[model samples]
Target: MATWISIEGHRRLVEIIPNEVQELWDKWEIRGLILVSLVSQLILIVLGNRRRYKPNICTRALVWSTYLLADWVAAVAMGAISSNLGEYYENNHKKFSKYYINPQLLAFWAPFFLMHLGGPDTITAYALEDNELWLRHLVGLLSQTALTLYIIIMSWKGNWLSHLTIAMLIVGIIKYAERTWSLYCGSIQHLRDSFLRTIDTSKKIEQQQESNNDGMNFWEFLANSIQKDFENEERRAGDPRNYLRAIYIFVSLFADMVLSPWDITQDRKELHDRGCFHWSTYFTLVNNELKLMYDVFYTKAFANYGIQGLISRLVTLITTIVVLASYCKLSENKEHQVVDQIITYLLLVGALLAELSSFFFAVFSRWTRHYFRLRGSATFCCILGCIIDCFFTKSRVHISMGQSSFFTIICNKSLIIKGNFFPVNKLEKLSSVSHRLTSEHVLQKVYRSLYDKSERSLQSNLSGVPGYRSLLLEKNKPIFASEVEFHRTIITWHIVTDLCYHFYDEPSYHFDPRKNSKEMSDYMFFLLVKQRQMLPVGAGLITLRDTVIEAKRVFEDINVVTQEDNLGEACRKLLERSTTIPRNEDLRMQSTSILLHACDITNELIADAGEYRLPMWDFVEELWVQIISYAGAQCRVDMHAHQLRRGPEFLSHVWLLQAHLGLLDQFQIIPH
Candidate 1:
């Protein structure tokens, strides 16, 4: 009897719960979905702009989730509405007057979903890969539009609400089309093709030949034109217009397009004249330019420019207003339910607010300023600039460099009692810390080094530090200068830098080259361990692991207390070990462990500084600049573009600056 009663109770629950859920879903499904869609739009408009600057993992994840959810919710709502209209039509046989819930209001909701699918103007592609899926978006546009049209046609009552839906549908299509076009235009293939079409190759060749005969080259003439256009006081360096123009000309570099000799010559001359060699000016311009490019590739900045963009905006605004007015007038008729009327009003108000917000972003956009200047609309541009200055204050780019130290990693490992049983690689990653604001002094030194090396070809520039190899050979330290593998060299130098940092007395001045070298060393190690994709393909993992194992063994033998506070003692202990290289050790065998080699380098640097009365930190600092710049120049173009979406990398800035300065192979033609 007890078992039978339990079975009967289970059966009742199974039947009752599902029926209750089904009834609830049937009543509130469409209403719940539409509300979700509205809230998503609000979230996107408020948070979309944050991703460009804030690259924290949590921030990006939140924005990414909302970006995807907004589209999915809008699409699902449309399908739900379509299903409801189909059911009503099949059951009632097109008898609109007898329906309890008006089908026309349901039709009115369909176009709002279409508008939601259009997305906010602040963001279009969440990642660089999203821009390549333009064809998928195009198909979605067609299918969703057809589905919306079918619903509207099924519920046609030839009334004010139906007419309002038509007007809204037109606006919705325009907005959706704009997003599709933005993705298409941002695709690598399309951007390259468009760029090629704009270049008059035949004319360029003719000009080149004629100028060659005149003892001046085509590049010189083009350089003069750039000066005339961009070097004026009103459009001088640091101007957004200059950055826009530079982007227009140099964006092709991102597509891996080989620039002609004339192009490189023209750009190098123009950049130099613009004082791009000044470290502050160079970084600021590059940072601003990449930020604009991010806007172009990932946002609606490209789509909402020029006469076409203006006309679309005007049409969208007019139709949205007209539809809102018509809805208010129709609400007076009492043909729709109070609940449906309220929901419709909420959607309309949301749409209007979204449109106005989009317009505001577009008007103050750098793209808009560029467009107006190009059209000679000085008055409008000036007015917009004043309005922008009044409202928005420019914020500095937050540049944080990742720092990972071998000494820190080794010293901190003792905290974990499991030791070798635990994953040391994970510990290394966790040990890495990031410092806010890369040193301006370091950047200045790097700029000076690169500018000095710009006259050399890419091969010669990256073939070891410019002038340090000969000096090392003179000191009989050839092995340090001629390390077989780049990764080995990085590990060797990083250990040497850590030893010097802890072993030596602190420098008197705050901006000493010693401090700068130490910071750069840590940053490079960070890249080697974490962001190796931005470096050349190599056995960095093997190199890092072997070096770590050797370091652990050394620490164990010495019985060093491996704690963060005892890091200096640990470094000094390592330095006290024998600095002699094994007599018969093969260079290849030496790769097994670089710790002793690093000790030798540290001694040689200190000895050289004392003997030659030269600043050892200068050589160390410049060597790091060469290593980092080589890494930047060697990084794949696609990887560089990919990092832009995440946040600006120092390496990407260096890469762009190298291209402009004719230090990369992309600038194929060497001007005489």
Candidate 2:
């Protein structure tokens, strides 16, 4: 009897609580949702741009959450307002007047929701995939516009406030339309189609010119022109604006559109002649081009260009200001509820502030600078350029590479919990606790390696590895690094790199090739383990898992602790274990464990370095670059485009650089 009574009372309490909550929601739902929507917009405006360079999980999550919720919240608020309008009409239009807030104030709030649907100027799509959903947004635009119009029509008072509502509605629709158009243009199919059209037109012009010209082709003529331009030393000093223009021409390549031989030749000559072949200038050009591409793919920067964008901005600004002023004049009567007036004032002030901020971003944007320069608006471009130099001098690209260590993952104990019997290595690729800045020395070395390979025409080979065999032979190693499977090669090299990194004493060189090699090894391993989708299909995870399981057993026998000082000793002991048995390729391949293979490679590298009297770390560094570039070139084109939405990947930069250098297979030279 006591249990039954208690259960019945508990059920009654559950039933009573929802009734009270429902009653409260019905009263304050519209006001609460509106305020929340406003807060979301403010958050997006402040935090959206940070995702480009600062790709920490916290920032991405907050920005992504706000971006998604900003739309949903505004749509829901509009629905609530529509429902309220329906109720007011159902009650013979007398109920809202009896309520504390006027129905017209509720109707005024609907336009604010429409503006929120437009989103902030900083971000449009969170990922590349979001751009593909333009039709859904178009559908949303029509439905939401209809719903908002219905709300305004039902609650029309034909006063100054009504006129203000109509004006704000116009601004809201314009903003939403711009976002939809941006998505449409940014879509891959549309982008590719536009590029094809441009290419077709250029092809026709080139054919006409070829018939009129001497025996020299269009590319040869362009190359000569570029050589002449290079005579002016001032032009060779890299300009950021040049990269902005290059993006317009080369962005189609990222969309998987083919470039003609003449196009590649012209681009290569321009880049080489302009001193962009140097490491620093090359990376700067690539980084700036990528940032511009990011703006095109994911921001309103593309839509807010040219005369139409300017007119839209002007009209939206004027209309919003006019409406705000009209509302201020109308508010003088003070006959409405205090809460209603306050909400209306907040929406107006928020809209005005958002517009001003958007305008500020637009005027100082790289796109705007490029536009004014093209249009010969020198004064505007010069002034804006000066302001940017003075205030925004920080490098926009984050040049740091993420590092994940296989040894660290194997030794980490926290990854293994009691309930989970899974391998600790498979729990999660250990979070990158550290990052290495892409030093200029490494960049120069990589640039030289790729340039040398391109000159030798080695990049045209579609079989085996690109630069692996030649680099290995230079060290007197008869074995091909590609003898093993690609994934196994990565695992073996990574482990070998780690062992060598710990076993050798720190070199006194100013630019330590050991450190560079270690960073590339860890970064490639990080991609294999964490970002596998960006790489070619392989059993990298399985290879890594099997290798980690074997290493875990070795660590258990050695009773190792994962401290800095003890890591070297642990590596020394592991090396001793592997070297104890004679190296055998059959044994290495038969076993899933790559630790032995890594040991064999390490011994070979040490032996070859001693025999050749060469810096092993130097060869190691170049070999890793070859591996990375191979992966970068072979990676799917769309994957590189997809990664741009996240922080810029070094691999993508390399891929773009290779394409620009005419090193990729995509740039086939068709004979005239």
Candidate 3:
């Protein structure tokens, strides 16, 4: 009798603990999760929308954190709710159960979890790699759908909310499935193969029609319509008026699609010939291209664009609103705690508002305007265009007269200019320098330097000619430069260029090529440190960091002017003060050697460019462009695909642009 009593006491204690925990969890769990889910969705819409405006570390971290946590919180909440519901069911079936039961309430809440699992369309996946896990998401859909259905069926055996629960469950399944399908469709290989298949089908049909047009079959009609549509697409793609269409064509080229080089050149020429649009257009176009890339890789953009998507979205919105209203009615008539009633009402209102906002954003988007062909009203189209333009057009980096690029530098990275971390007068000086450079910048300097080298190469090629027969052949073909070599060369060259500019006191090159070189060098370094995946193979942050540490160490030993006030002074001091020291230290020896090599190259360039009258700045600019182009081309398509997880980089854009312009050496196909 004593043993039996002890066992009974232990069982009661175990049961009591779970009941207490369940009661607490049931009261606060759904309310808290609903609040968090609603807030996360709002944060994503607001903060995520501003990502393009400010591409800094803080914004990126915040967005990434919110994106990850939002999904995690909602999923965890579902599991918790299901566990509590199961516990309640077992207790209610007991002969002397301690827990109070509300099967109807439990049934009503299960569908909300389904909706949470569906997630907001604004964020399907945070990065490109997330899309690659579409199969995993599909698995999640199956498991979660099964769990939700199980909960709904078990809880709503005699519940009035059963129909509403089923309705919501259907809506949730559709949304979650859409996200998974969009991910599969957006994967790079899949997207590319789709285009290839379309091209192949068109070709096959064309051949069939040519062989037997008299027998006008369904295939022939379909082929002719496809051909006609393709022609119309190409026309629109080439037109300057449709920037979005142009982006689509260029993006296809980057995807390894076989676009004619001549056609690309002609289209570019036409755009340039039509207007002075190149300067401002490139910035806007790049932004748009990145936006499209983001949409394709990160969001439910493709899934939510078509007529079918529109209809499905409409149905989802209507059903969700109707179900929410039904729940509100149930709350009003039922006897429930005031706080619980208020919380339920809040979730309903929040869901409705979120859906409404999403609908509005979609309607006003540039993609919608282009797709629906709603251009009948001139005033309406103009207004819509302006609104869409506002989303992309912020403070642009315009190289104009009397403007400060100091802010541009700051925005790109933090800085201490002229011993002042942030100051008004230094900003004024930087602006004046920027403005002067812009007004006086020359393209010929770059052209003449490259042209002279090309002419020499051509002369060497034609050795049989009277002037070239005696020319000596090169010992070997030039090796493709690695990323380390590129970085080391540019940093050393940038320093040497500074020394030359300051030592010679040549004011002419200072404003144009000198400034341009400094900016490009710094930008490349920034890319190396912050965006390593975008760079050519062999470029590592570790290598850059080690180099910088060595540089600082050498500079400290030299002690020239205490802090190396500017680029010119830093270069001058390194060459004059540091080189005078003994080459005992390995780091210092390496630094001195780099300085000497840069000087030697500069001398050779000067000798080779004799009497050509090409400004030194022009030669430097040409060399920089060649270096940039080579690096860009060396990066593979697979590398670009890998960047889906991290986000797009500026260098990738440069690579694509270079390929389009036929600047990349390997991409230079002769128009046969």
Q: Give one clash count per candidate, in the order shown.
A: 0, 0, 2
Stretches off by above 4 angstroms in model 3 are 1-26, 49-54, 93-101, 157-160, 204-245, 253-277, 373-484, 497-510, 539-557, 564-570, 578-596, 599-614, 638-648, 664-672
Clashing pairs in 1: none
Q: 103-178 in candidate 1: lDDT tens per residue?
A: 8888888888888888988888888889999999999999999999998998998988788889889988988988
TM-scores, all models, native as reference: 0.86, 0.89, 0.72
lDDT of 2 by residue, 537-654 (tens): 9877767766776676666667776565678888888877776656567756655677777777887777767744247778778889988888888888788777877778888888
Count backbone overlaps in model 3. 2
Q: Listing every candidate in turn, what is its Cα RMSD in Å to the true structure after a full C-alpha superposition?
A: 5.9, 5.5, 9.3
Candidate 2, overall lDDT? 0.74
Which candidate gets the maximum lDDT versus the true structure? 2
Model 3: residue 403 alpha-carbon error in angstroms: 18
Sort the candidates on lDDT, descending order.
2, 1, 3
On TM-score, the candidate that comes out on top is: 2
The parts of candidate 1 lying over 4 Å away from their true place are 1-17, 93-101, 201-242, 274-278, 332-342, 385-398, 411-429, 455-476, 505-511, 578-591, 610-614
| Tens digits of lDDT, candidate 3, 204-255 | 7646655644443222233344344435534433232345435544556545
